[model samples]
Target: MELRNDPQSHYALNACIDKYYGSKGLPCLPYGGVQIRTSVIDGQIHEDVYEKVYFVARKYFIKYSIPIDTKNCFAMLSFAIGPNYVPMTWLVTEENESKFRVDNTTEAVVHNLAMLDEYLAGRLI
Candidate 1:
């Protein structure tokens, strides 16, 4: 993944999640995007990965009263801005949400990262 010019913001955000939830930080993909691995939960998958993340983020925003948009998913989480350029948001999949509830945005992110890490490490079946 292409490194961001300023990683501090993303780092800070991850730090926030770690502080609240415990480390399971997000991952930076080759194209500078973020993704979380999830499995079937209650026999339902949200379908749209980006949308699901946005929805969860919206819930977080409403709960925390933070001003953020689902549009900035990549920038805020991965520090990688897309060509179109939009607000910062995080992307999550329905399968993932099934495994972990997004009651806490930071914790959700951390859980996502931990899941991804496990998948990469071949710890997840």
Candidate 2:
């Protein structure tokens, strides 16, 4: 399924995949935007084609020794704006969260990237 917001914030490190999303055909990532891109994950096939995304996240989990439900179809990436800044996280969806069981409130909240940009500007929450 499609990710919720900023999609290109993720780049699967040279992993063999995308039988599910066959070459986005973009020469490269676009400039200075939210980095939103799309990939597909379908359980109907009961196989994974997004292992790059999944495994990269797994790497972080292992490094931090954090517990993650690999069965869950999302990865939460935390980042910082600059030095002395608090972390902010963006949740990348490997599948539709509205379809899967989700934590922290049981459902996905629809949000627009542009609007979120306006909201988070400098406030940095």
Off by over 4 Å in 2: 2-68, 71-74, 83-86, 89-115, 122-125
| Consecutive 10-residue window with the lowest summed lDDT within model 1 | 58-67
* Model 2 / residue 57 / CA error / Å: 24
What's the CA RMSD of model 1 in angstroms?
A: 14.7
**Model 1: number of clashes?**
5
Predicted candidate 1 versus true structure: per-residue lDDT over 13-113, tens digit per residue: 43554454332232321222334333355897532222112212111211111112222222222211343322222333445435433332445455544
Q: How close is candidate 2 to the true structure, as a TM-score?
A: 0.21
Q: Any residue pairs clashing in model 1, and if so which?
A: 1-30, 72-87, 72-88, 72-89, 73-89
Per-residue lDDT of candidate 2, residues 37-81 (tens digit): 233456342321121112221122100001122354343222233
RMSD of each: 14.7, 14.2
